[model samples]
Target: MSTNPRGPNAIDRHVGSRVRLRRQLLNMSQEKLGEELGVTFQQVQKYERGANRIGAGRLWTLARVLDVPVSFFYEGVSETLNQPGFAEGDQTPIIDDFIQSADGVQLAQAFARIRDSKVRRRILELVRTLAAEEAEAQAAESEQA
Candidate 1:
């Protein structure tokens, strides 16, 4: 149960996103993760969705099961969360969601296997050029409409 009426806290969501990201990167299913944690897959889903708060003990277990340090979950947490008027719509969560997706994980794994820095740089440049072209095409289409 979230303490705030507004759903899961930002920190909880961030932690959940990290959990999902790591789990996906490892190519582990939620069912497998839950089996290792001795919990139901539904419970694992809740943890990943931030619907349920993970206690310290459970978090420690998660770290053990996931083979990540407990601090990994907090790696990219914003320093300005306590500041007034902090914007909630950050790109990190979007990127996290993508990284947790099947296609994104596949792409990331393939990219990681590329040991040549020049090849990696060329692939990145190709991707950027494609993205810029897509964006320009969309803008032109919108103007035409």
Candidate 2:
């Protein structure tokens, strides 16, 4: 891969896009996230623009506040490292799309409102089962193709 100091790394840009997408999905403004993180909005903007590196501590805090795994930012990034910028061939992190939907936000809010541990566990189990079934179905389809 060609190294250019002025150009942003594809991984960095992708991760920044994911972070910005998630922040928007949660209806969070950069100012709000900055307030929560005890930083200026400009700093948050820099992070989102990939102009500044996000530190591990800040990433952890961002994950906690955003209700996602730290891996969420890096998901699908490996395949695009050599690309100059994110391209259509690279996987568009599905979580970003899912969480950006209105239904997704509602579902997340509803889940958060559920105070019972047992119910939460059951919900998690049900989601897992559904996801597994969907994966199996997709695999079967691909096999037939």
List, residue by residue over 25-79, the lDDT tens digit for candidate 1.
Answer: 8889999999999999998888888888888999999999889999998877773
Cand. 2 Cα-lDDT: 0.80
Candidate 2 lDDT tens digits, 1-145: 9778766666667777778878877789899999999999999888887877787999999999889999999976765364566677544446545654557767887899999999999999999999999999999999999
Best by lDDT: 1
Checking candidate 1 for backbone clashes, the offending pairs are none
**Displacement of the residue 40 alpha carbon in candidate 1, Å:** 2.5
The number of clashing residue pairs in model 2 is 0
